[model samples]
Target: MSGTGDTAPGADAGELPAYAERVLSVAELIPAGRVMTYGDVAEYLAEEGQPEGLPAEGGGGRRVGGPRQVGRVMALYGGAVPWWRVVRADGRLLPGSELRALAHYRDEGTPLRAASQGSDDHIPKIDMRRARWDGRQDERDAPWDD
Candidate 1:
């Protein structure tokens, strides 16, 4: 599959590889309050047809199981992805241009599982271990469970 041609909220359909598309889909599914890590996105993207077993770092030579790739993707072309749903591994909001992601979170009313003021310029990241969502509960499922 080359391109789905369906640009989602945080992704550019035609520009992304099929795997990135899949990751974007999963990210879109994340509820407003919950969040996912880059590693999660990479794994999900792999599941969606991204090549697996390849190293994720250093041009895919290093093992990448965390959220770096996903975060990088979102940082550049996350306009259509549910970017707010994909936070840094530390639970800190992903950096963005013009508070775009933050606006979505505030507008969507996503729960702030972590503390952040945005004034620090260097936001306090969230702890993914504690903030990463499994999408198990009803509320978690609502954002994309349909």
Candidate 2:
């Protein structure tokens, strides 16, 4: 991966953990100008299919695709995808790469909220209300949609 200068385990051999591949694919599916938080990505994957590294329900095993795990996947293998589209739940720009992310957000017409005048960095935040993508284009008949 081209991000953070540290390849994930097995990355040097052009391989990624199956979970990492799933996360990256979700990142790719996010439309330009829209975003998913790490939690959202994890939840989406969970609702859609059986995630890698996760045991089936009632198996009493640990799960591996929570928000933090999703974030780790992005940090390691995100550069090949639209990394900026995966954002924090609070809508704050990614630290250390705020400017770069801002450029991508602007280019994609993603909604943004201006920083308050008293802010130190004065960086705009993503407008989560407007920019968050839930991966649902229509109301599914699932009970959870209630």
Question: Which has the greatest TM-score?
Answer: 2
What would the TM-score be for candidate 1 when compared with the true structure?
Answer: 0.54
**Can you give the TM-score per candidate against the true fold?**
0.54, 0.78
For residues 1-146, write the lDDT of model 1, one tens digit per residue.
11111243434335665445545666766666567767766665444233444224334323343466565556556656566677655555654432555566557655544445555674444444444666443553333221
Q: Which numbered prediction scores highest in lDDT against the true structure?
A: 2
Q: Tell me the tens digit of each residue's lDDT in model 2 across 1-146.
A: 12633344446777677677778877877888889999988887777354354334434223557998888888877877889999999999988889889999999999999997998999999989888887754323121221
Single out the weakest 10-residue window by summed lDDT for candidate 1.
1-10
Residue 65 in candidate 1, Cα distance off native in Å: 7.2
Q: Model 2: what TM-score?
A: 0.78
Local lDDT at 27 for model 2: 88
Q: Model 2, which residues run further than 4 Å from truth?
A: 1-10, 49-63, 137-146
